[model samples]
Target: MSTVVDYTTFAVGCLLALAGLISLLAGWAPTWLRHVERPRLFGAWALCLGTFCVTQLPALRTEVIKLGDPAIDACVVLLLISAAALLLGLRRPRRQ
Candidate 1:
């Protein structure tokens, strides 16, 4: 069950990251997402968050663990900061 959860998380995270990348570079996004005031910024946040989620998988965690606790903590902090920056940079959507 845990393995299943891990794979699901990884898969979801990958899809999210891919979508974010596409949105950020190509400006292709679903209609619902177009309503956002700053789609590109949101995309950047999604990419960072997805990356963080991917790193949370047990397999990746094990690799990071081999590097030491500080390494893992630093990576988490960096990703969080990056995601937060992108999110905070976004403004409220204009009134339609």
Candidate 2:
């Protein structure tokens, strides 16, 4: 059951990241810009989703129980930090 969940999570994460990349390119690139603006928002969400998948990956690859748990935990922490950064990035800077 856990393995199934993990695989699902990984797949969802990958899709989200890919979607974000496509959206970024679609929105920001002049040649292929999207009709909708605000690609960065999609990029940020994809980053967060990708990080969630990263947290799940250690157990799938590593046999060592000790190593996998730490890696997973670290990724979780990283995901939080990155999400915070994304939120900050989205905020408009105040002019003096």
| Candidate 1 ranges beyond 4 A from true positions | 82-86, 89-96
Top-scoring candidate (lDDT) = 1
List of clashing residue pairs for candidate 1: none
- Please give the lDDT score at residue 37 for candidate 2: 40
Most TM-score-accurate candidate: 1
What are the models' TM-scores? 0.73, 0.51
Q: Scored by CA lDDT, what does every candidate get?
A: 0.74, 0.61
lDDT of 1 by residue, 2-81 (tens): 99989888888888788778878975556766445566766776677777778879989788899998978867885886
**Range of the 10 consecutive residues with the lowest summed lDDT in candidate 2:** 28-37
